[model samples]
Target: MKKVGTMLGNIAMYFGVFYALLYLLRSTYNFEVTLSFAKFLSRNQAMFMAVLFTLITLVYLLIFRIKGWIWPHADNNLFRVAGFRRLSAPRVWLMVGMGLAGSLFSIGLIVIDDIAQLFPSVPALVDDLIKGDSAVYVIMGAGILGPTFEELLFRGLLFRELRKVMPVYVALVLQAAAYAYFQPSMALSVISIGSGIIYGSLYLRTRSLWAPILVQITAMSTIFLLKYAGFYAWYDKLNEGVLYFITAVCLMALIGGSIYVWRTSDQGHDWIRVAKARMADTPSAAPKGG
Candidate 1:
């Protein structure tokens, strides 16, 4: 329980730092300059957010390195410690395929009034956030950079911390709950909980942070692409029968993709085992001559 409290505190600390810096940056200018800058930021909100996320990601990485939280010591590499080891090419494709399938499945659910209808305003909020934003900025920020930071924090840092004191399943739910707790809206919170569990399980299954990161990037980018291509507008024109058929197909694909990912996932070896194997093969880790 104490460890869980500390984990929550860490999450709070990260966000607290983020918002504090944001406030300072936005308020540092003189009144007239601040007003003008605020107007500019409002217009280029997506781009500004991307830049801010990039800065914060770098800052956190540096802090973790210095504190030995990510890097640990001179003997350890940051990427390896943080679950960035290479995955097989085939598995990579499977992970991405599953992610894409899941995205389409979500869309089908929304179209069929199976999910998004539960949170009535989420669609409008999403539209407002992305519809008028610059395509490049929105894709870079929300699709790529945003997921990178989140996966690094939740599945990478927070998950590691939780795993030290609890079983994997317990850690999974706790971290997922923490992720959801920070969301700005109830609808997003609900969605975040689900996505968080998926991402956390992906991390554990693949034993690599890249798994969830790639999957999330694929899912979010696909959604944004459909939105930009006016897929929803076209969907509305379809008759109920056709819509139901398409959604059913998507549902089947989602189930198939999930099965593929599960079957192909490298569950036999965890990061620790892989690292030990690598070290055992290294000449430096061999026994010294008498």
Candidate 2:
């Protein structure tokens, strides 16, 4: 129970610091963005979030140094526990394929009006950036930086912490729900929850943050590029039957490819070894609180 409380506290602290930084920056810049809680998440969120995460990461690293907190050796450090490890070339290729298919599959989800209604800001932000002559920056920020940081926070920190106190399956669900909590509407929440589960599974199954991070970056880049090419406009003109057929094919590819990867991937064995090492070290690693 104590461990659970500490985990929960850390989750809260992460998001709390994020929002506090957002508020501070907004105030410092004297941006005319509204002060209302409802409007706090402006459309420029991706760019600002990237900045905030960079700042937070720097601060945490500095604090760790000042506190003389030496990271554990390679197999036991926070980075290791958070799934920051490598994968075989085949596994990496499989993850990239999965990401591509998943992004294509997501078009079906996006066309569901209720599910994607609240997500317009993402494309809108991208469009705005492109029009402002910042296309490259938006891609780097949204496609790479944004997804990397999210994977670090949600799949890395949240899922790792949850695994310490519960079975992996339970932890997966809890972490997914926690990730979805940031969505503003129930429909979007459901979508995010589902996405979180997929990313979490990728993280655990591959035993490496690289798996999910690559998948996310690939998916975001694919979608953004498709959007930039005006594919969505062409898609809108398709007959319902053709659209359904394409969506079904994409879903089949995603599901079938995912199953293949899950069966063939050997990285989970590494995670099991890491978990055992963690269990062995837990007692000694606990703070003395003297």
Highest lDDT: which candidate? 1
Off by over 4 Å in 1: 1-13, 25-31, 68-78, 113-116, 131-133, 241-263, 270-290
Q: What tens digits encode model 2's per-residue C-alpha lDDT throughout 89-142?
A: 887887788778767766655554443565765444445544423456557767
Ten contiguous residues with the weakest lDDT in model 1? 281-290
Q: What is the lDDT, from 0 to 100, of the residue 143 in candidate 1?
A: 80
> How many clashes in each candidate?
0, 1
lDDT per residue, candidate 1, 1-290, as tens digits? 66457656866767776887677667735477577666655665555667677777767766556656543332233355457867789878877886687667656555655456777555655565584347887788778887787887788767765665566677789889989987777887887887788778777767778888888888778877788898977876777677778766765664565556655675664644533443333334211100
Report the lDDT of model 1 for residue 20: 75
C-alpha RMSD in Å of predicted model 2 compared with the true structure: 5.4
